[model samples]
Target: MSSATQRRVFLVAALLVAAVALGVISMGGIGENLVYFWTPAQVHENASKAVGATIRMGGVVQADSVDWQPDTQALTFTVGESAVDTATPITVHAQSAPPQMFREGIGVVVEGTMTDAGTFRADKVMVKHSNEYRAPTDGMAPADLYATVEEL
Candidate 1:
């Protein structure tokens, strides 16, 4: 090929390589920012590795285990199945209010990192609803946000 043609080809090849490299770099950042999910059993099994690691957990809201301090908007609860053979129970604590669908017998997904105290300090709370059923009127105010439960 002529000198001019060769120069143009080289420039094109270099630009293609540079673009590929830039795309890879940007993707790497996105992958690192992505969080993971874990179930209550898995969290307990891998407590050390899960410490300070952001993850999501799913389980049914334990009956009568829910507690809320209306004055401070603080809440604490235990979630799990009634059968011991199922996933282990987990405790969650949060300063903010939970989603509107959250209630007794409903499943939930709590997103946050585990602390040394063994409490999951939830940054986000999700509710699990069955399609066949709808919540009845309880004469209570609804929450600000709602999220579907996602299994870890």
Candidate 2:
């Protein structure tokens, strides 16, 4: 008895399979794989869709614009917006080997891609200390491996 044009083609194929299963369930929802660390004024306000994509900026490290050349391990710098204020800066350019708490104004994140002559060509630098676990007021537990504070 399925008359009326086969029940309107089975209700338009069940509303077109519920709109393609809600567009693939909103593409696996919930930020899919959240990992944003852009700063330095959000990478100069997304500098034209962030040059070539791969981002993760972050800031502070522009004191004398460090130029670590540990025998050519190469690692230029210049990522301000704090550390007494160097305003908007962003000249990363890393090649590797520079960690050991890296110095000058600290706080970095780097990651990569943004050249076109604007610099920030890192591959991955990340050096933002403070995991917090200070249980050594110096009674005899001296283990200060690269411990730094430079000023609270």
Candidate 3:
């Protein structure tokens, strides 16, 4: 083969190797940052694989399971499936203050990792609000639902 042709072939091969290396490096970074979403039941079912990995756990807050300590800004709650009998509840502990909308029976997605001791330690808690909107059902006008401005 001509020298020119040999040089061109070498350049192409070098470019291909560089491209493959870049792709692999990018994929490694993405894999480390990737967080998987799972329901409380799913997490429980796959507890062995989920422990020590960051995940997003979604479920309804169990009634009477929330315990907040303002002095320490510690919040602990249990998340369970909508159908209580279907799956066991998962307890979550978060050091941050609970969101203003946090309440029992509401859906929540907590981002954290499950400990070996069988509890989830959350760094961020997001309240999942319903998409459905409804007007006041008490036969009162929308304006009546809001207290007088003077009350504020």
Candidate 4:
């Protein structure tokens, strides 16, 4: 092959190697920073691998499972599937006051790591709102729906 052709081939090969190296390094960083999103059921299924790994757990808060102490700002709650009784719930503990919209049966996503004791130590809690809006049903006025807001 001509010297010019050989030089071009070597340059192309070097560029390819550099591109591959950069891709691999970026992928490694992404893998380390990735936080998996899991439901309560999935978390239970992957309990062994999930322990101590940062994750985001999302599900509906179980009714009557929220316990918030104002004095200590400790909040503990259980998250489960749409039907709380259908699957085992994951316990989540956070050291901050929950959002005002936080309530039983609401969808929530907590970001944190799972403790060895199987509890999720949440550093951030986010309330998930429904995208679909429904009008008041029969016998319920629009004003009735706003009663809770009025009380607040």
Top candidate on TM-score is 3
Could you tell me how far off, in angstroms, the CA of residue 20 lies in candidate 1 after the best superposition? 25
Q: Give the residue spans of candidate 2 off by over 4 A.
A: 1-28, 37-51, 57-68, 71-73, 76-108, 114-120, 137-152
Q: Give per-model TM-scores.
A: 0.60, 0.28, 0.65, 0.64
TM-score for predicted model 1 compared with the true structure: 0.60
Where is the poorest 10-residue window by lDDT in model 3? 143-152
lDDT of 3 by residue, 1-152 (tens): 99999999999999999999999878767654564578888898889987888888999899888999999999999998872524578999999988877889999999999999999999999999899887768877767546543344
Residue 59 of model 3, lDDT score: 90
**lDDT of each residue in 27-140, candidate 1, tens digit only:** 767655553556677789889977798778777788787898889999898877542324578789988776766787787888887889887889888887767854635763
Per-candidate clash tally: 0, 0, 0, 0
- Writing each residue's lDDT as its tens digit, candidate 4 over 1-152 gives 99999999999999999999999878767754564578888888889877887889998999889999999999999999774655578889999988868999999999998899989999999999999787777999888768757766
Off by over 4 Å in 3: 1-36, 83-86, 136-152
**Candidate 4 deviation (Cα RMSD):** 6.8
What root-mean-square deviation over C-alphas does model 3 reach?
A: 7.5
Q: What order do candidates take by lDDT, descending?
A: 4, 3, 2, 1
Off by over 4 Å in 1: 1-36, 81-87, 134-152
TM-score of 3: 0.65
Worst 10 residues of 2 by lDDT: 143-152
Which candidate has the highest lDDT of all?
4
